[model samples]
Target: MKDDIVLSVVLYSYLDRPIFDVMLNGSGIGGANSYGGNGMITGIRVPFGKQALTWRLDGPPGMARNGETVAMKNPINLAAEQIPADAHYLAVNIYPDNTVEFVFDKYIPDRTPRGDQIIDKSERHGE
Candidate 1:
């Protein structure tokens, strides 16, 4: 296996919903992968709130749907920002083999969530 490098950070949380359902800015390494069915990889769902998130770097997980689940096993604690947080956050890095390493701050009230910054990071996912 090659050295594990930072792939992307999935900054999102489900909160009361108990599930994360979107890939923040940073997603897909070595440039965007336009394959797998519709060829568009969309949101990713962690098992529950305040949990680590994972994804298949080998193949795209496809658009969000039922039964599609990922987990935040490494980071025991989730992170949030402010008392009334809009969304939780999880920093993740994807290894070459397709295994994702979630960088869990393990603290509630994580950094602010911004869609603009999200896509901006996505632009640099593989970079």
Candidate 2:
């Protein structure tokens, strides 16, 4: 079987509530924004160009499992070549029936910080 699948992971809160609401991490001022409902993590339109997946993550604290699950889809010809290095962990195997089993790993980066929030706050107060 050819390996072909893509997935991403994030530390989301209130994601497993079984509803459609999902809270996503946002930029500076608004720490997070709600996107989906109960039991929701994200809403992504799939079969998107590879360029659409270049994600930038900020320094995080630890690896957290997203209790909620969301899916994005793409309908492309399956080939061993379409797989990315990050998706290699998916124990790809072809079944005798010609169906492919793609067991993938969660794509996430270790949490890291660019700077000190306390210092930034202090600077603002002094100014």
Best by lDDT: 1
- After superposing candidate 2, which stretches have Cα over 4 Å from the reference? 1-40, 48-50, 53-104, 111-127
RMSD of each: 14.2, 15.8
lDDT of 2 by residue, 39-100 (tens): 21233222322321111122234434233233223223434455565552322221112222
Alpha carbon lDDT of each predicted model: 0.32, 0.27
Clashing pairs in 1: 25-118, 25-122, 52-71, 52-72, 80-108, 80-109, 80-110, 81-109, 81-110
Q: Model 2, residue 19: displacement in angstroms?
A: 27
The TM-score leader among the candidates is 1
Q: If candidate 1 were superposed on the true structure by all CA atoms, what would the RMSD be?
A: 14.2
> Residue 104 in model 1: shift from native, Å?
9.4
Q: lDDT by residue for model 1 over 18-102, one digit each (tens)?
A: 2223343233312122211112232333332343334332233453443344443444332232112333333443332233344
